[model samples]
Target: MRREITGFSNPTVKLLKSLRDKKHRKREGLFLAEGLRLLTDARACGRLPQMLVMATARDPHPLLDALEADVLASGGEVIVTSADILSKITGKDNPQGVAGVFAEFDTSLDRLDRSSAKIWLVAQALRDPGNLGTMLRTGDAVGAGGLILIDDCADPFSVEAVRASMGAVFTQGLAQAGWDDFLTWLRAGEGQLVAASLREAVPYRGAPYAAPCFVMVGNESRGLPEDYELACDLRVTMPMKGRADSLNAAVAAAVLAYEVLASLEG
Candidate 1:
């Protein structure tokens, strides 16, 4: 049975609206997952939100039956709300019929299971949400074990990032750590740290990509700091004949990640 929320004063609605901000999300340990597709992905990953808010103005989506039933079975709340209310929560006009407020998953380098992980991706100071999200999607496509986000990166849980991820956000293992901490963690591990750099003499194809690989990608502008690049086990460069000095951060990451995947298979 679904609870009908007809007014703006509902506590659930307020909480969902507040989650649009990063600080609020971090404080509450919650984030919003909009659309049926993302909810479907969450359900597939066994990470479905405890609270669901559906637009009552639209016809029922047959796809939502199983999810709604599960939520109700778990003693979770399903809100039957107006289009205006859904739009207010999602900050979009005539938003999708389904939206959910899910608790964020905790991830850390220390918590990562290295035993089964073949390769991981580290993005240092990557500020673009679209790039980060796209990279995550790419990482998922190539079967990366996980992703490490360095200091001051875009909030991966942000609406733009989550939307851009197209459901990869739910499937991928993600963690955040500062530069020093990440470096320490990288060095402590047995995996080969392959840093993507513009200064490296070795071409990307020639890099020593071994099992348990960790591919490090830099920021949109500055890239990996020189000392950081020098600290890596292997440094590789992608060659470009055109005037462009470097590739997009996400594109560079994808290229390197795929190569690492190929190396393991080879």
Candidate 2:
């Protein structure tokens, strides 16, 4: 169905805006993504948002038109409102002119197939949404099957993270689990859990990197907890030449991911 919403007080507006809050998103089992590019990337990845919303003043684009048609053909709703109202819903002064409501798909760790890819990225207690999104992108770039988010990481479905992912969210598989649960699942199958740590560690390059190697990173501020680092089958450390003690959590994951990819492919 195609609907035009002009009033900010509309109930649908309220519902879409509420998705910005984690509690509301969880309760509704839905999350929001904005921007024509992100939504278009999602469409290309076989993920059509349940609801596609756009501003009446949005500039015309072939991609946007194609997206709208695809959404409607797939039984999705299309909403058009003023850019002002779009900004209000997105909590951004400059809205992307388009936003979407997507049903949160399955993210259970059990659904992950370990042998599907040579490398996987894991994050523990990641607090920053941008970092989480960047890791997802890194996983996509490295040809990792997906990203397994461990413990209390930021909501990957959040707007900031989703935006930062630049559409990797739709392209890459995502899973969430606690450390114990993740460990059990990883140990059940043929996989190597490698952590970036100094304890009993070898240099990251030319490390005994193996197929389905799970390159795990830790909390941004604290890094990996000692026991968690120790639990890994392999510990690899990167050199820090500058005054900075370590790379950002996401950067570390990307750096380590590329190294693992090169080692496995070469």
Candidate 3:
């Protein structure tokens, strides 16, 4: 059934407002997706939000029609509200015309397909949401099996991260582990551990990225811990002729990931 929410006190509106916070989102086991493109991408990835909220005065009406149809067909509720309500939900004065509340996908480590996982990414203590989001997109582009977040990393489901991913969040499998637990898993896994480092590392092109490789990257400010770097089977570095000490973490990961993929194709 289509419902029209006219007041802020409505239960659904309150719930949507609470979801803007990370703690509330975690407690509810749901995340909010905003914008038409993101919702379309969510549907493409086989996710139907439990509830969809739309601003009543969207200029391009056909997109809203399609979105409403898809949501209703999947047994989801569609709520139409004023522009003010949409702005309140998304914290933007000029908000997108649509938003959705989706249950979090299972990103547990054990859920990954070990056999077919040609390359896996491990991001350690990633603090930046935008970087992590781009990494998710890059990982998907390079056909990585999944991404594992070790230690204190940004929430992939956060609004900033999700927006930065450009919908890649729905397509990429994700996992979380601590440094020690990740080390244990890495030791038991059957792939070459390739890490990026400046000290005692070979050129990126020279490193052998064996099949079922696991690429490890460190935090934005701090590179991998020496012990972690030592654990890797190989370490590689990108060429830096400019004055910059290091490249953006996402760019560096993409370059290495594509290189690894290209090697396999060759």
Give lDDT tens digits, candidate 3, residues 66-182.
878988998989999999998898887778889998998786666777567688788989899899989888888898887888898989888888878888888777888898877
- Tell me, by lDDT, which candidate is best: 2
Q: Give the TM-score of candidate 2.
A: 0.97
What does the lDDT read for residue 157 in candidate 1? 92
How many clashes in each structure? 0, 0, 0
For each candidate in turn, the TM-score is 0.93, 0.97, 0.92
Native-vs-model 2 lDDT?
0.92
Judge candidate 1 at residue 65 and give its lDDT: 83
Candidate 2 residue pairs in backbone clash? none
**Candidate 3: where is the Cα deviation over 4 Å?**
60-66
Pairs that clash in candidate 1: none
User: Candidate 1, which segments miss by more than 4 Å at Cα?
Assistant: none
Local distance difference test, each candidate: 0.85, 0.92, 0.85
Residues 109-152, candidate 2, lDDT per residue (tens digit)? Answer: 98888888999999999999999999988888899999899999
- Tens-digit per-residue lDDT, 103-216, candidate 1: 888867787765567788889899998998898888789888778898889999987788778888898889899989987886776788887776655888856788788888
Ranking by TM-score: 2, 1, 3
